[model samples]
Target: MTAPQDHAPSDVPPAPRGGAGPVHSDTTQSAIRQSTSGMPTRPHGDDVHAAAGSATQPTGQADWSAFGPGGSGTAPPNTDEADRPAFEPDRGGTASADHALAEPQRVRRLKIALMVCGAAVTVGMGVAIAVLMEEASPPLRVGVASRPTGSHAPAAPPAIGGSSGASGAVPGNAGAGAAPANAIACPLPGGPAACPAMVAIPAGRYRMGSRRTDPDAQEEELGGAERAIAPFELSAHEITAGQWQLCVNQGACPPPAQPPQSSTMPVTGISWDAAAAYAAWLSQQTGQPYRLPTEAEWEYAARAGASTVFPWGNQLGQRHAHCGQCGTLPDYAGLAPVGSYPAQRGLYDMVGNAYEWVADCWTPSHAQPVPPAQSACHEKVQKGGAYDTLEADVRPVARTHGDRATPDVRVGFRIARQLQRTEQ
Candidate 1:
């Protein structure tokens, strides 16, 4: 074996040796391919041989977790040259010609990395559906705060007029009080004093008026006119024509062909069925029932609880109301009694000296269940509206109409009730 050390091997092949050619020894690649297939071998040569030094096999170093065969996922233990085994077929190793052209280029780079992860999941689901369609749309709202826009100004409307703070209409103190016992009888059939004189009002919920109808006191221009109204109670006065001659002395009020020289003045030209038959003869001589207030309960009882429109709020003049103010009578010329006009609205000739009558019953405007007194068969709603009307018709829901029979100095009526049928 020592003699075999006279080597020239690193797969020897420099060619042209003496005394017998064709002897290439890469150790034994199947005996050098069975002694050089078909001969004419050119396994390179070595002149006299005996060069010595190619007996390797001592390459020590292999710990990649003892590699291959044991765990099986192959390839790590070859440590550079542990007897460098593989080569043969006359040692023509060129790394097996680049691992046979790199196995189909690793299956074409794994199908181009799964088509670039499915087009990045279809462009991130089309940008999350365009941010959920801009968060589902619809919301314009500006005004920075409202009434035209921001910087805060617009206020001021009060001196005697303000209401409609909640906006339902007609509770200007529907004639001040009394009401709560109606099993039915409001027919006023002929009981002379027909109705009125109930008065107590109280349970509270005010601030009515302002559905803004003063567009220069309107002939019909009508723009955003939602004049509001609240509070409630009124009638503590007016209905005088000598108190409808005590219902024509009780023939159930039919007499006034035109009498009344002055029972202290207040009643006027009559008719909401002669002021609901004199407030149903003062609610059947005081058993308590009454009726007539729904122009929002007569301006929510004429702003009794006060939010304004003339219980001394928006100031219409005549010092505050008696029409023509200090213009010294005659303009509306008649009616005065019922506390001669003053309580701003807490009571008294509502706001002037004439236009009374009002247990409601008309609606070419106001709107609500309020149409009962025979649905305008002729006329019946009236609230402070005359003295020829004009300082914005003396507000507090100012309105007018007549003919429940006729009688006129300017027309008069007041009183209201039905708080679930009056009597308490």
Candidate 2:
């Protein structure tokens, strides 16, 4: 008389009464298969128990509680979600599907961060390198000399031979403080073609003494003042042995006590009187005035329009001049070839190589008044320093005294000519 009991389809299994057999829905079987695709199978006895426990489960109820203790419907308590695998599903949706969707975005963010860091490091290195380069460079120096004297004199005109009493005198108003308009270069007649050329020095006033506070200035070089000079022509280099040999071959000059290293070496070991005699002979032959440079004229030409100790700068360097500290050769290895070092204003060896004999009577200091005329020459002033001298002694203001008749290997002389005006 009871209603017929609801029965499952003939292809499906039936649920047991009183929960004696487990009931498993299609969802639970599928979830188990997916989760355990690669897992080792359980023992035959455990498999039978799991099959019986899950056989009668209903659909839409695939919680892991079925496999937990006592087959209870409640799921196990979990405190940390991070313990779950990326492939596991959550309450909201399948966890593996959500992870697959968000993985590309996480990778993209990581790549962006790495790119930004790399770019920042590159920029930082570039900035550091730029700072280093700036620090390694030297500062430029400009306008280190005193103000110009507002004079622009032309180069000397070529020399012309003429008979006139004024040709031997100082030209261009020597004592009247007038700038010379012309300078002449008179070539030595019958002299060797290798003789050093002459340079015209324009008449101008220049500071005649070293500054008292200068590091290289000596006590004798102090008390400097502005001095006026007349225009003149000076030899471009110290007189070489070859140039002097021309006079020697003609019996116009005496032979050196010791032979020079080379014909081009500067003629050293010549006395002041011998240098003056050479100048006189050259004047008579070339028909122009030639003599030793006066003390003021020697300094002006050596300064070469610079107010520095050397023509180049206060500090001495190898390429500028040769001295004991220059390191080019052994100390006092004799003289170097003319123009072996640098030149300023067409003059060489103005600071070193050989001490130059100037046309002034030796005075203890520049403070002493120079006599208007020569009384009797005792000691002559020598400007420029020799190769064996200290670098500080090579300064233009530095001076030393030597006997006029004594010949020294370290002493040499350069000739100067009074510039003359020619009638058109």
Candidate 3:
């Protein structure tokens, strides 16, 4: 079977919008619905437990037919056990044996006693039944599936990748759901207005940061920062040109979607403000929500499950990345559509090509010796080192920040929207 996970960047260029027209204009109106159907149920554990309990005891299923439809002239004597549940003794009378009881009088006394005892036994049985009903159900336990005595291929387990032996949790969550912001600037491979349609990254946590021994860990490459970064989410691909158009169409940003994007290329030419506006617009349309990933999330996704500087691994491979390739530097002078390189960071163009914007406002978390006279705020960090420089420009922790309002030729962005609600 093919492995369930593999993160190789796509080299495909922008696509034409001819297939599906743009997504709906208002994303906020998109509703997140929960089912209104009745809750599903399985047989209660107590029911089984009660059945087993009754089996152990001598009590039988209730049957009333043996007495006949009406009292029969001929009847069998009552069994002693019928009165086993009740015990009562009659009080001695003050005028006992004063005279030999008459034949009818003696018989009448005996019949009255039996009648009283039968009534008491019936009531006791009813109370016992009620008590049995009140006990809690039995506990549930999962057991191994029954396998045929002799089989060829083994059965696959239900959990994800079947890695963990335990049954994973039934998928669901309770929540109304999700938003927030920042102005980030990135250099695009192309001008703004032509970014392509972006892929939806289902909301999930991913690991980020890198291990030592990476090129960035070397003396020459570790130039900007040193600190531990938390995990976060990122868009599957870079922001597309058409997505930016949605924000402009809403009248939030001045520039409209431009010409170059065929619908699949990464978005470019947008300043940080434009990207932030698109995020807000998307949230409102879903009637639910959306937001850019935190800086931690962005890097986590970029790492693509790897602890290396790039998603592919530590040593840079020319064919895998687009930056400073061969004897020549491949910055290429402009944004070249998203996914322009597959071997780069397990995601397209991550190493070089275009510096992508992140959600954090310009600032440094642990920029080494720490900025002496200033706060970490006021300067943003960028990832996927860009072209137009030595190889150092592409280290994972590389940092830089520029005007949020102005677009840069070498910078671009991708958009991210969070899920509205999960199951309970």
Candidate 4:
């Protein structure tokens, strides 16, 4: 008798190429239908050929080759048509007619492999997403970490008012004995509440000059050493017009060569001697130690915890400050008003607002140290490059010297105060 042809179940969908969901077949459904009809199922042995030729073949069919008497779980080897078995197994397992009811072995293995692969893909995606999120947002730092004198490790800028007292009040200013270890810079006791706004600076260390490989390095900015700065307070903004005018009105300072259009704008064209006189007048009025920042202190403050050429970064960005190559805005003809740009570490206009005078006397190079003083200085150092200053010259380490008696439209100044002993 002729062997019957093997046929695949209609309910089972084709297996996917790569790892996909589990494979399902109609093995259980076929058995349920046959048992419900009270039909005695024919064995897959010699009855298939007789059933096929007599037109009495069962419609409810299942693959049972793997569990049959003479069958293995895998497909049989290839042979001639006449010698081959009547049924062939699907990709997962062997096929046969000897057994009436049994699940194919290959289908179970395919389902297990697909389930494991699907689980692995899900876990891999979860880990990748978590890593990306962490890189996108770093945590904020609450305290300053000490660094070796010249270490180039990047430091995060502290929050406004520093990690110490919030109101710019330090324990040192309260009394004399060893102050609380956490107390930072504050205005001296008895200072007016409305004195030029100041931001407390934490004690820190930094390299004092341009790197040896800098292309813009000048003789005066080279051969410098590392410096350790004590805690102090620096003016939040460059000295404004109203602030300078107050000094002139009290007769403690000479009138400016040109009046500023707005009281909030920085006062310019003031000689170094005149700027020093204003600082002295402010100290007397507010009862705070007010003076020009030393050259080293000015550079350190301007850097604002950055190691790049510019405080913001290495490249020049639009509207960062009012410099020639730093980009322009429609607001002003000359200098933008004080606090017009975003601040760094609570201090505004550290660079590119105006040329600020420092407390150092101008020497040919940084090889020799110049002591900071408010008097008896011939040539004074200028920092924080002016609005018209070139981009190449608008870095923390860049400097220019001016005659102490001369005042230019581009030159201006800000003040700094030292932190006193903390309260015991």
Task: Locate the minimum summed-lDDT window of 10 residues in model 1.
Answer: 1-10
Q: Residue 108 deviation, candidate 4, in Å?
A: 83
Note each model's CA RMSD in angstroms: 44.4, 38.7, 26.1, 29.2
The lDDT for every candidate, in the order shown, is 0.40, 0.52, 0.36, 0.52
Task: Give lDDT tens digits, candidate 2, residues 160-243.
Answer: 211111111122112211122243354655443434466777677765656778764555666656677878878877888888
Sort by TM-score, best first: 2, 4, 3, 1
lDDT of 1 by residue, 213-252 (tens): 4322322111223334332334456655555666677677
Clashing pairs in 4: 44-97, 65-96, 92-106, 171-423, 172-421, 172-422, 179-422
Q: TM-score of the candidate numbered 2? A: 0.55
Model 1 regions lying over 4 Å from their true place: 1-237, 240-243, 246-248, 251-265, 268-281, 285-300, 304-306, 309-313, 317-322, 326-330, 336-349, 354-413, 416-418, 421-424
lDDT of 1: 0.40
lDDT score for candidate 2 against the true structure? 0.52
Q: TM-score per candidate, in order?
A: 0.25, 0.55, 0.43, 0.55
Which residue segments of model 3 deviate by more than 4 Å?
Answer: 1-214, 217-233, 256-264, 326-333, 343-346, 365-378, 387-389, 419-421
Ranking by lDDT: 2, 4, 1, 3
